[model samples]
Target: MRNIRFLVVIYLICQNTLFAQNNPFYNQWEPSPKEGAFQMEDYIVWGGSVIKGEDGLYYMFASRWPKHLGMSAWVTNSEIVLAVADKPEGPFSFKKVVLPARGKQYWDGMMTHNPNIHYHDGKYILFYIGLNYEFDQPEKVGATRELYEEAWNHKRIGVAVADSPFGPWKRMDAPILQPRPGKWDGAIISNPAPVIHEDGSVLLIYKSAPVPYPARNQNRTMNFGVATASHYWGPYERKGEDNQIKLLPISSDVEDPYIWYDGSKYHMLAKCMNEAITGESGAGFLASSEDGLVWKTSENPIAYSRNITFSNGEKVNLPKLERPQVLIQNGQPSHVYFACRNPEGQIFNMVRPLRRNQ
Candidate 1:
């Protein structure tokens, strides 16, 4: 009887694994670059956050801008818009704008981008980066040179709460995470992706850049950083304030950090501009951490668009296909999404598959 019971348990485990592999959306994603995948002829979609709502639908919150303005215009001009699809690999239909320009009443009153959505305590929290007037105006642009400098001095990370994923979200009156004095992130606090541990503490992974010495805009290098809070609506404290947020065991020029816990360990996928590898553009690099604070990049890049192409004739070779985001269904990773930019540098979110066997 004991031998039979042990065999039954082993058979059940194999069956469960087979069922998970059979899931269509599981390990079945591909770049949904159908002709006219983007609804607007002139606007490109980028910096999106995806969530599976209670209504059994997938919703994406992304930044959109007029194609004529180009990707560089995202800083000063882009707005956050909503798109929805019946499935994860979407022929997603454009929905209404979530956050429009605030018209100078508040700091992020000009542009809202980098939407990161997660559900906590029966509420959905939308964390994002907002550009204030200090960073948006052309006259003040010289005050800060690098992306991190501008983000620290001008941008702020804020959160909004709603009962449902499709929210009439109530935003916190003040920013949740801001720059501090003499800290690695003291220069800027943006790219708000949060990971909730089993113990209920929230670990928010973000990007920060130190102010360049010579004050050259292009010299600035963005790196991944972390902050922690006892509660979700946090006055999040940087992990190593006294020691400084350690750069994720990789060289500089990494950003758009997305982190998750894969059963036993924490994993991260980020976009890095490593000139040595691709010559000009960069690729997506994978990293892992035993604890959330320390990170080491894998010797090999997990994915590179330069080696792949989409159906819509978008060559992944260019400096495009950054901002990697993954989709989890029932606690297992199923899909990896990337922001595929065009020749003019306009960004559109694209999907791809993730399976070891594949």
Candidate 2:
């Protein structure tokens, strides 16, 4: 009877391993050179979220501004827009600009960018970055790097709540995460990567840098930081401020972290900005943490690269790909979504796969 039971346990472990394949990464990828409705001849689109709606359609929450406004506009004049698609790899149609610059009096009056949408606490919560400041050059299409650098240093993470994916988001009076006065993130904090658990705990991994020395924009000591809260929206406190959660070495940094908690641990995918994972710039890497505070790079840390090939056997090397997000469907990673750049206009999506063969 003991030997029979032992054989059954061994068989069960083998069966489960076969089903999961012992690999959670790798998948098919497709790209639309120019994306969705808002890709006007004069508009620039950047970071976003693509989620399946309860209505059986796909909704993308993204950031955009005019090409005439110049790239720097992302830090000064960008807003969160909504678009819909029938399929995950879409010719997504622009629906509306959901979060716009309210007014100078508001903290997010200048720009609202980096939208990460999640459903928790019986509502849809929009995690994003907000920048606010006073400026007089309305007629000018763009600002100088010095001007943008000043505005960007004030960026903070904010959240908006809505009953449904479609509408009526209520934002707070101020940002939820602010830069600590004398820490690594003392100058700026943005690019929110949030994972909301069933028990209502929220884990947010975001980007940050220390105070500037010679000038604000010249410093490039950007790295990842961790914060957690009992509720989806917080009162979030930074976890490793004193030691700093430096996943990579002090010489290298990671950004655009998308975190998810499997049953046993926390996992993340982020842009390997400094050749830390793949020994190349503009690559994607995967990592995990048992406790959601300290992280370890996967043995095969390089997940994908900016240069990608499709399942159709066609390939093209992209100049840039950033802001990686995984859409979880039915307790598994379904689709990999991210932003790509083109000369004609910016693409709000790269349209990738998450399965081994796609």
Candidate 3:
């Protein structure tokens, strides 16, 4: 019996090694460019989603808020903005603010963030998280926790439709998805990652919480769910058991997910909130789902680490690297975009090219 157990252990190790070797996304990262980053002198940038337009240009919808307002103010002051680049690996220049604070009266009036752009059925769909609160906007870095908590609970997934990327966008009066009052997603819905199908259906994944803000501080956890809509803009219905996609049986601590359907199967890459499955905090993990509802971790699950390599061969583990977005060209992933913060508090959007012909 002891020998049999030892054989089982050896089989498991061999399986892991074989899977790692066969994983397409593993070791596919090429050293990134040193200069072509999207940044602003007075703002903190995050969550960049790029799409190639019919005009033969790349358009990026990203989130940014004033630097003086502090990082926590992202819940209150962030806005969705547009940038343009000639190439996917971009030195993208800021074009304009696409979604800004209008008023607290509107559902998404206060702030817009985490833009995920898609082009489908002759229209451009911009998916994001927005929030509103009754209080006045905070001025400086140190704001009250109450103010932050209130803003956090207000987050909801929203979308804006436009004929062209250049826009006269028609934003909805109500959000596309909202929190369930007593359900697992009772607190809020944020960080939308959507894949618009060729048949005009949409499979969206978003971050959710069980309890409202401040209450969840004692046990901070997040859950991810998949919702489907027949049309791009629609009454989306949650799928799976209890409307939650439990990626890991042990922990539901993943966040900032980016999902895509690459012809055959659905793929997801998300930030590992804890070292539960990936064994490294802040690493990106890959998961696969035959259908959008049921998902399992990819064989070599560690998609990326915080450590980044430059074309010049310098490697640095970023202090903060979150919000993974992929730019797919001709049904192939060409580059991956990330929101990174260095130790000096400098925040920017970085793009790393993916090795092709895999």
TM-score each candidate: 0.78, 0.86, 0.91
Local distance difference test values of all predictions, in order: 0.66, 0.74, 0.85
Ranking by TM-score: 3, 2, 1
- On TM-score, the candidate that comes out on top is 3
The true-structure Cα RMSD of candidate 1 reads: 6.9
Q: Write the per-residue lDDT of candidate 1 for residues 1-358, one digit (tens) a residue.
A: 9999999999998875674443322223354454323346667677567788888998878778666755565666667778888987776788888877876777677778888877766787788888666444332222333543444356678877789655687776677766664545556677877887666578888876665233436547666677788877777877754434454444567777788886677777676677542233566655667777777754443444445556675544555666667777777666666667556554567766555343
lDDT of 3 by residue, 1-358 (tens): 9999999999998976676544545677899887636888899888699999998889999999998887888888899999999888888999999888989899999899999999888899999888889988777778889998999989998889999887888888888887897788989998998989999899999888889977888857788988999987888988889999867444558899999998878888888877876777888888888887777885357788888898999888888889999888887677889998866667889988888764
Worst 10-residue lDDT window, candidate 3: 16-25
Candidate 1, residue 159: how far the Cα is off, in Å: 1.1
Compared with the true structure, what per-residue lDDT tens digits does model 2 show for residues 133-208?
7774243674666677667877989999898776788988888777876777878878888888898888888888
Better of 1 and 3 by lDDT: 3
Off by over 4 Å in 2: 1-23, 27-41, 137-139, 212-214, 241-243, 246-251, 310-313, 343-348, 356-358
| Model 3 lDDT on a 0 to 1 scale | 0.85
**Top-lDDT candidate index:** 3
Off by more than 4 A, model 3: 1-22, 248-251
State the lDDT at 259 in candidate 3.
Answer: 91
